[model samples]
Target: MHSIATPKLTASMLALALLLAGCATSPDFGETLETRSEQASAIAGDYKKGEKLIEAGRKDVREGRKLARKGENRVNRGEDRIREGEAMMAAARAAYCRDTGYATPECR
Candidate 1:
């Protein structure tokens, strides 16, 4: 009889200990998950904003490249014009030297 009573008391004590342990570690299912969800959404929004900024920066870079290429083309054209003008001047100097029969220093 005493042995049966001892086993029952032990079983009850074990059950009570497990119950308290479970209660101590129970999760808060509402506010904790809600707060975490909000945080996740905010992070996603920030990520999207960052992507937009990066796209804008890339567009600006492309525009800058186009402008630089245009400027380079203008410089090349200016150089070509200068070379053409120099050639014309040389031809005119040669003609003047031959027509006047006076060899000028520019003809050499």
Candidate 2:
């Protein structure tokens, strides 16, 4: 009985040893951690660059809107000036017709 138990114990010990050896052959945890750390840093850098680009794009949009508003204001002013000029021309034509005793080419 003692001999049989001894053999069984040795076999169990050998199996445990084999399992531990198999575990040791796996990839190193430190190296895997280092690789993951590098990937994270690269992702962070790209994220920062993307943020800067987005901010620049927002600034450009703001500037474009400002320029468009300025142009629209200029167009409005020009239209106003044209209306004023037309009013003046009409007044001048009327005055000329009255002063010329209706002999002006415009009155005729």
Best by lDDT: 2
What is model 1's C-alpha RMSD?
Answer: 20.4
Which residue pairs in model 2 clash with each other?
none
TM-score of each: 0.51, 0.56
For model 2 the TM-score comes to 0.56
- Poorest lDDT segment (10 consecutive residues) of candidate 2: 8-17
Off by over 4 Å in 1: 1-42
Q: What is the lDDT of residue 31 in candidate 1?
A: 38
Q: Write the per-residue lDDT of candidate 1 for residues 1-108, one digit (tens) a residue.
A: 457545643333544544454445547535354454455455556666776898999999999999999999999999999999999998998789898786667655
Report how far off residue 64 is in candidate 1 (Å): 2.4
Q: Which lDDT values do the candidates have, in the order given?
A: 0.69, 0.71
